[model samples]
Target chain A: MPIVTVASPKGGAGKSTASIILATELAHAGAEVTILDCDPNRSISIWADRGTLPPRINVRSDVGESEIVKTLKQQDADGRVVIVDLEGVASRLVSRAISQADLVLTPMRATTLDATIGVRALALIEEEEEALGRAIRHAVVFTMTRAIKSKQHTAIEKSLRGQGVDIITPPLMERAAFSALFEFGGDLRTMPVQGKMEPAAENASAFAQAVYNRLVGKGL
Target chain B: MSDKPTFSIDLDSLKTRRKDTTPESQGRVDAAGEQHGFVNREPNRKRGRQPSPRVGQVHAKVMPNVADEIADEAKRRGVQQGVIIEEAWVLYKNR
Candidate 1:
């Protein structure tokens, strides 16, 4: 079982969206996924409540700093994957969750403010690695991107790469389906058609596969 | 959609590794987080004694001696006067 934590200190950086997309996609691919909604916003819980959660996906909400580690340990088991969605603040809940994560995915939109704040999560991971004496695998995934990359997006990607940061390819585009998950409650397949559903599913599927590849020790 | 190849997960390939959840390791993680301004953000629970849940009112006037005894017993037992009243009611029902 792998615990993938979606964390970012910057608000509106798509941490919740990324968590749902990954969890649902993984569940669709025949993996039992448990999502711990640690965000006070209750984004995942609301989504799970709105509609029938896709089969093989279970959502637990209101996981605070104290219960995070314990809840993660309880939910983790063979043949299951746990996804933790953290609040968009630098809090002990985020740190404690990251400490138990097999992979920490920091979702950042293509903006300077987002990158500046999201990098704090990466720095914390580095420090945690040194303290825990084990390498904590982490990567950055750009969310709410456009079909055409902006100059700022290119610059930030370049800067991060220069710093030897692992950036997940096929960044999640600003798709209507991605946002519609909150309203529809189910995955893209089960939700009503929003915009062009094909590309959205493809993007989410590939992004999840990239993550799965990493989890299985395959790079990129 | 059926024409496209869907992603599939090989369950056997996924492995779970042991993580340190001991207090010492957690303390170190917390320390590192604090250095980066990720301190405890949990909402503070209210301090001091919680409000008593005995909201019901009893208008019965007891004899002076019985009232004094009840007050002294409540104080000695460190419980609200309501507890004594409830026990007395139960005793009446049993009788």
Candidate 2:
């Protein structure tokens, strides 16, 4: 019954990718899910519509930062799992979603600039908790990363740990399969399960599955 | 006197003329099989031990009852609903 939210302040951080991919896997696993697209870009909403996603996956594009809490409260009352895809930056709505989230997954690229902005988002979450007196479950993940760790990646991870922030390992690798996702409007699970596939597609699918497991837990 | 006339129904007079018909209030039994007054105030004597750590199971319990609490919290803290719930949960969970 946890509501997971993907939020970040900077663009190109794989927020949309993470949201769509994880949601797709969960829906495939037979869970009633409602994905609220808070981004004005409407990327996830559009993808769902364009691809005619499975019936189990209900997409709500009308959601915004302002109405998310009440909506989630109502949905929680109805016993539906809520997954929010938040827009970038520290907007009023983004903060509200983070405040309401059972787990706030903030995605950042493996770069100094991304990690720097991530600290700001983490700070905002902490400040909101202090001022509002609500406990918000939160974690950070690095996305669109190369296989090999760079000096910047190690430093950023260490810095975040020093700040006492939770960060998930196994950062998502940068690959064309993820980029191709927006075009086909399909995620890894929806792809051919048996046929031979490109290396990038296989890697993307593995990465997506790994993330899905971490979010929902082992059996899922 | 003017052709137009005005009449008023007297609420005060009506109240004095009605018979009382309320059901008698009943005392509620606590978990320890002890009866207590109808009000929500704490019992006169300590009852059973505190609840188990299962209190965490009801975190979302606050979300549904938020409407009732929001008005009270807003008036007490002079802050917005988002801030009050957020801060309250943090304090509630840590304890």
Which candidate number maximizes lDDT? Answer: 1
Off by over 4 Å in 2: A77-80, A192-220, B1-95
Top DockQ: which candidate number?
Answer: 1
DockQ of each: 0.58, 0.01
Show the lowest summed lDDT stretch of 10 residues, model 1 chain B: B1-10
lDDT of 2 at A159: 86
Report the poorest 10 consecutive residues by lDDT, candidate 1 chain A.
A71-80
User: What digit string (tens of lDDT, one per residue) describes model 2 on residues A2-109?
Assistant: 577787777878898878766664555445568888888888877876666764678888675436666766566333356789777556556556656666788898
Q: Model 1: residues >4 Å from true position, as ranges?
A: B3-5, B54-95
Model 1 achieves a DockQ score of 0.58
Tell me the alpha-carbon RMSD of every candidate: 4.2, 27.4
For residues B1-95, write the lDDT of model 2, one tens digit per residue: 11111121121211111111111101111111111111122224557786667433234445547777786888788876667667778999999
